[model samples]
Target: MPAPERLLPYWTIAVPPLALTVHFLLHSSAGPAAAAVLVAALLGAVLSAVHHAEVVARRVGEPFGAVLLALAVTVIELGLIVSIMFGGQPEPTLLRDTIHATVVLVLHGVAGLCIVVGAIRHREQDFSTRGAQAYLTVLLPMVALTLVLPNFTTSLPGPYYTATQLAFVSASCLVLWLAFTFVQTVRHREYFLPLPATTADEAPSPAAVAPARPPGRQSLAALALLLLALAAVVLLAKDVSPYLQSLVTKAGAPAALVGVIVAAIVLMPEGMTAVRAAKKNQLQTSINLALGSGVASIGLTVPAVSLVAWWTHTPVALGVTPGGAVLLGLSFLMAILTYGNGRASLLSGVVHLILLATWLFLIVVP
Candidate 1:
């Protein structure tokens, strides 16, 4: 049996159901003040669910842990996107903007923070060059084909892909993502493992060491709870969608802001895990979490959304704006430079962070 302290994370199991009930009972009739309160409550639920996800990840280990976190976040992100996509008023650019924002957030925001913090503490951190190369190999082409190429495609009108192009792009992304998953988890799993400590001083702290997997029952319980918590997040996102739409419309905020917000919310668990790993000089884990989430976001989310668009006969935009395309290209370039040499430094982190900030600034000005 788990300790009392360990069981605390299970509280997330209750959050979603409770939040869902509350939203259904009161959200429609609630005033702005109540809505604000509901939002805060839902946000807390998201954070709590993220905490539970981290606990579960720690029990699983390595590339699998990162993969689990990515899938969980992706599920929540997909729920939010689909909810909004089907919600009031058509926003054709919503999916594209959200995917673009997700890429930027993972590649630059989360990855940059990890690199900066790790480099500042450790001077430099070592990871597998092969792992980084593999990620970029799949990620670069995935982004270019799905996001950039659409802008220039003569077959489509105004960054919009025809049914044939969309089907091809969707299938291509799904296959590439599956190929990368096979390599990461099966064939080349060792590539993502943390480097051995060279000197006595470089040894990982106790907390940094991989924890033993919990017993089978406990692990199963954790998995069940994770699914429940994820379900709650999706339900809560649905409740929040109306408010978000209202706010965006009234405030005249850029549609990209919604994507950024959703990306940040979904990425929270993995982001926390990545930063912690980086701080402990576990750069490989950080890279895995950071880049893996990016890959999954594009690989999985794009296809799911595209299919939904097709089913509903909604006009979907898959291409980036000119400025978005340029920023994404730069982000990809910086990622290569940062991880090209099998090591990371403060400068690399700084470069990526600057790119992230530029992307954020453009949301308002663009």
Candidate 2:
């Protein structure tokens, strides 16, 4: 087996609580310079969160590790959003904007960055085409049922679904994600595993790469730290939301940009981990991380939000605007072609990045 995992950095142990304290007690009253420091601490927490998560993931194993990290972050984010929604009059379009931004971020930004990083380093990278396809297949339907279908439904006027229709859609997303998880971790586990590199320079031997898991005690420690970091992250992001909204408002940017900022902050750890995996030529693992984040964002967030909205008698919107639908359509179509061949190149990465840029530009111009 490869060398045992590295020692846990001290910052990893300290940043979470520091961020939590700063977010809760001091953030609002801080001056501009202090605010910058707080933002730095926030970013430090994100980096440390990824470090602890990687420790836990290595202790666990491939796709399962990714799933654990994704699910943990999503669950926390879902709780934060729900708590905020229940705290006051919730925005009807909050769920839609957040979910749409997540999908867009993953499909284009995260995946494209991974591809570009890996391809630039190694000329091209290979992953399990089946695995990529599987992610896309499940993602398409979930997006359609939750985002697109609501636009056309007549049971309720506008983009709002009737009670029965909402329940059906939520159930459908949950079921689809569960089935995809089963296939990913159990039935076709190999599909998500990293493909062997053809050259020694590209990848070390399997044993060299798969280091022995940390001892039981270390594993437990890592798990605890992971939870702590994630908890702190959610709180910090929630605190940042109002400030972010204010900035966007001052700039006269679209309201949707606020959701994108929230989603991006929430996803920073996962995106960082995925990009690192790509830099190491571990494209399969990166794809698993990127696509897995997308799948979990919708599959988990929708049902949780739906239940809360239903219980609170809160109105929620699920449908995207025509501009959003076009972006979604283009993103999915590009995903199909990108993963269709099991190979990724610099060109593919650049194309996807352009699409993401188009998305950001449209948000401002449209």
Candidate 3:
């Protein structure tokens, strides 16, 4: 047999199962200590997921690699939302909140952090402008259609689409998603490739990225572990759903915060990976993950959500407040400039971050 790829780290191999075990142990419990353990395990599994995903990404290479990771992460996120929605009381706003949170967090928060970290390390970073443009091209329209259009449509009352409208919107998003995926992975894969860095400073930092995947079994092991990690992450997140609600209530936070927290936890590890890629001067890779996740979150999510909500007779509200619309518009405009510019710097990153902070603050205080 071919030599086994690099032996797997014990933690990467162990965390997912262990987290699942903890989830079973504490899933029904109601208390602080249990919540703490579950949260810790959840985080461990996230890190483990990232490690396995990176290995697979290395094995697969380029935009397809990015697509795999993004799809996996978004699937886990969608699973969490579905499980929670069906497992308990109706949460009509959950889908909207989660999708919105995913877009806002990925587009501004993760992307911003990547630029900041990369710029701080190298002072300048180069990535494929076309790649960024491609992501926004799909993402912007879908956002407007699903998140914004609902508010204005006369076919339904405030903030909803009639079944016909929902069906149309869902189909439209899926088409956009399918077309973008095909383009990114097949027709123009080079758009997502890491551009050749223009300066010596743009080189990968010594510790920025893990070494290449070993040839034989490591990739296979990673693929298996990635699946395991994703399951653990999704289930454990659902198990923690009660705590999120209770925590939000105790804090006197808005109901929407539950979605934000869920999105935050799910995206945190993935965002870290993107930041690391940026620090390595692989800004295109970071962009792929950021925008890819943003697009996939909406494209894949809305369709699945609409179908399920229809079957179960669940209500989904997909409109944003005026403030939310303004923030989203600003965010899109910022994303456009960031992606269109070809060069990334500290200032652009800071701007994106500011938009994120403003959204968060307004949500809390408004």
Candidate 4:
């Protein structure tokens, strides 16, 4: 078997960053725009990771560090994507569809499988059957008001108004997503709920700690280097957006593709972690991280962009297409199914994968 130490390097350095780089390059358009995005994404991903470490360190007592980190990354990722949308090149409906697509994939597809897998492994794990249902409560209304209604508009003033509607919708999304994060991270924080209670006489599980370093200078040096790398990534993303926009225009891909592409990039790190956790039979953590990240992405990104668009008078689309609405409905329903039971199985995993495929089909097709 491969040594755990060897695997650690992959998580800490190799994989998360490698994915970001490839995403930049593959999506880059030829010329200055491509170069700019490459630089910005690289810098952004690094800074984004550092910000994650800072968030984890600051919010130490939060139930899941990984989930919190995923939220943080989504914020940065959305920040870049939304900023790009402001420049001419992206589809008007890109923001709305992207947010919708991300929520579906993360909450239902990734989260559902995590729960199912966890349950299958532990058998005793609780899926919080009732709590999972809350997804339906929130998601249905969100989809209806924002996505579904737009398709039926018969007398809209113009495409400009459609863009304005998207901005408002983005704002709403940001608020909802962030509110959920606050609740999860700060208010209704996770306790050792599923873990068996320890008797007074029993020893507690030992918390993992870092080994002492030789000097404070080394720590500072590491921090500085990390910050520097992060700056580069953001700068790269700035340029990357134009290239991607050009590619989209050139290829005539659907609006939803932007969301999937961005979400996949944002999700790279947490997705790997979730898969690894499932393999280790740590399904609850995986479920929490994956689902939690999806929720956070919605709550946070929508608001952030909404505020910007409102301020700048840039238009964004908030409506979900009929097709997207159906997928969203199914995705939420599945999330309830996967997490409500507090257990998991390969069956649930397959279900989520199906949902993921459905999303891909929706985005790639006309």
lDDT of 3 at 133: 91
CA-lDDT, candidates in order:
0.80, 0.80, 0.82, 0.57
Q: List TM-score per model, in order.
A: 0.91, 0.90, 0.90, 0.71
Candidate with maximal lDDT: 3
lDDT of 3: 0.82
Ranking by TM-score: 1, 2, 3, 4
Q: Write model 2 residue lDDT over 211-237, tens digit each, in one string.
A: 666677777877887787777766665
RMSD of each: 2.5, 2.7, 3.0, 6.1
TM-score of candidate 2 on Cα atoms, chains taken together: 0.90
Q: What is the lDDT of candidate 1?
A: 0.80
Best by TM-score: 1
* lDDT: the better of candidates 3 and 4: 3
**1-366 in candidate 1: lDDT tens per residue?**
555346444456566566666666766664688677667656766666666666677678765775676677677788889888787755677788787877898889999999999998999999998998899999989888877888788876768889889989999999998889889888998877788899999887765565655566666666776676677667767777778778877888877788778778777777898999888888899988888888998888888888889999988877888888888878888888888898898988998899999889888877
Query: What is the lDDT for 159 in model 3?
Result: 87
lDDT of 2 at 119: 88
Better of 1 and 3 by lDDT: 3
How does candidate 4 fare on TM-score?
A: 0.71
The Cα error of candidate 4 at residue 134, in Å, is: 5.4
Clash count per candidate: 0, 0, 1, 37
| Better structure of 2 and 3 per lDDT | 3
